[model samples]
Target: MTRTESLANRLQEVLLNGRWIANTNYKHQLEDITWEQAIKKVGSLNTIAALTYHVNYYLAGILNVFRGGELEIRDRYSFDLPPICSKEDWDNLVDEFLTNSEAFVLEVSKLPDHKLDMPFVDEKYGTYLRNLEGVIEHCYYHLGQISFLKKLIFA
Candidate 1:
């Protein structure tokens, strides 16, 4: 398979799910964590809630730009960290996160091969691959943090 195809497939496996491996994904370190447990921040890192928001931020940010949505920072608030004091709120945010993630994956899958080589510059990351793989990497980076925070809050 082509590099983009491989990345797209794996990204679907990891990010399309409604939630991360919290104790349920056997190989995932944070398995078994309750959603409530996912929202608490026991240390220096952002709570799973915040990390999830950041993931959504990049997902929406990239997808939006691909769809002719502007790259202005002010317009990127949909993915910013939100307060996660209650289970319902956390559930809602998580759902939104999943929805955006799925949308991003689908969007990236449709990108033309040439478009992948294009350059995109913004305040967030100065230069980036203008395609699906970059989006997938951004998602994985934040997911790593979310999974790590899950361990702290739960295990």
Candidate 2:
């Protein structure tokens, strides 16, 4: 497979599903989570819902880059998660996250290998591959947080 295709497959495995990695995908990790459980905070820690939004915030920003826009997100505003006060609200958030993730993966898959090495928007931001891989790494890091928070809330 091409490098871009490989990256896309890896992104898909990490987000939607995974075969080689077993039960570590985002969808698998989020399975059966309830709004009440997601919004619970443990000792000043972030809620699962908040972390979910935080991760998606960057993904959405990267999506903009793929769609010919500059990176526009700031870390200070990353944690401004919306209220997940109802199951419908939480469900919609998940739906939006998943849909955007799918689209991001698709857009990245369309990139030629040469574009991967080019700077993402500007030289200061690093290459497209760097940012893309960074997004995946960022998701897994927060996914772990969400997993731990769920244990605290649901266990």
Candidate 3:
């Protein structure tokens, strides 16, 4: 399959996909939560909304890098969306993050096999793949954290 398709599959299957995984110890699989509930605290007071925003922000930054722009590592899990946070904000940063990630993946998939060998200095982590593959890897990494956080928050 194409590289972009693979990346898209990863995103849909995990990060932005619906339907949580049942029979799993991970609380991330806990489904049917609204934004309010996501940010609600039952015991530990962990907000899925916060995790979602952080993941989306990081993904957006990486995608921007792939599109030949600067990669800016934004905030982590917090109350605000970091760098840009407002009720009047775009209100679609998460969606935009996913969209931009997929677009970046598409561009990378079309690259010639040799192009992946090129070198680009990473802003956050220097000396990396300098390709879309790196971006995909980074997204999945954060996704794992989001999932794990869900477990802790729910547990």
- Compared with the true structure, all predictions reach lDDT values of 0.60, 0.84, 0.50
Pick by TM-score: 1 or 2, better one: 2
Shift in Å, residue 50, candidate 1: 0.5
Q: Kindly list the per-residue Cα lDDT of model 3 for residues 17-36, writing each as its tens digit.
A: 53433222112332434444
Kindly list the per-residue Cα lDDT of model 2 for residues 1-155, writing each as its tens digit. 88889889988988888746545777877778988888887999988888889888888988887888877999999999977889999999888889988998899899999999998888998998898788878877787787788778777
Identify the runs in model 1 with alpha carbons over 4 angstroms from their true place.
1-3, 17-35, 74-80, 121-132
What is candidate 1's lDDT per residue for 1-155, written digit by digit as tens?
A: 65555555666766754333322221232234456776665756666666666666766667778788777544347446656677677677667766776676676667665555656645455333444555556656666776667656655
In model 3, which residue pairs have backbone atoms overlapping below 3 Å? none
Residue 105 error, candidate 2, Å: 1.0
Q: What does the lDDT read for residue 21 in candidate 2?
A: 56
TM-score of each: 0.71, 0.94, 0.55
Top of the candidates by TM-score: 2
Quote the positional error of residue 137 for candidate 3 in Å.
4.5
Which candidate comes out best when scored by lDDT?
2
In candidate 1, how many clashes are counted? 6
In model 3, which runs have C-alpha deviations exceeding 4 angstroms? 1-13, 16-31, 42-46, 74-91, 122-138, 141-155
